[model samples]
Target: MTRSEVRTVLLDAVRELRPEFAGLRLTGNEHLGAELGLDSVARVELLVVLEEEFGIEDEVDPRIFMTPATVNALVDQIVVAEGVCR
Candidate 1:
């Protein structure tokens, strides 16, 4: 899927997982934890949702979760993992 499509899916998942983010205008550059207030547990949950949404099979690298401070970065990681480009 295209990056924009991926971003839309990701944002939908985020809204489903955290209703408080529903009306927020996310630029995909906002930090998931620090700026978005997602704790470790929430981060893991988000990762799980992404993996399921993207059909990722292998175990996701822990570093992937740690490094991405923004939703765009996280989407980049998913793109790489799914072997697709924008």
Candidate 2:
């Protein structure tokens, strides 16, 4: 999938998981944890949603959630994990 497509999917999943974020214009730069206020639980939920949305079954690396993460970074990770060529 293209970056724009990945961004759209990520935004949709994030909105579903966090309705408050629905109004925010999510640039790829927004930090998933710090800026978006996603706690550990929310991050996990987001990852689960992303995995389900993309039909990804492989276990995600826990380290990815250990620190602040950005939308672009997460999308890149998902695209790689899903084995979708850019």
* CA lDDT, every model vs. true structure: 0.72, 0.69
Cα deviation in Å at residue 61, candidate 1?
Answer: 3.1
RMSD of 2: 2.8
Off by more than 4 A, model 2: 78-85
| 1-86 per-residue lDDT for model 1 (tens digits) | 57887677767767777788898877888778777777777667776776687676455664566667777898798678755545
Give lDDT tens digits, candidate 2, residues 1-86: 47677578767777777788888787768888777777788777766765676676455564564454887887677556545536
Q: Which candidate is the best by TM-score?
A: 1
**Model 2 scores what on Cα lDDT?**
0.69
For model 2 the TM-score comes to: 0.67
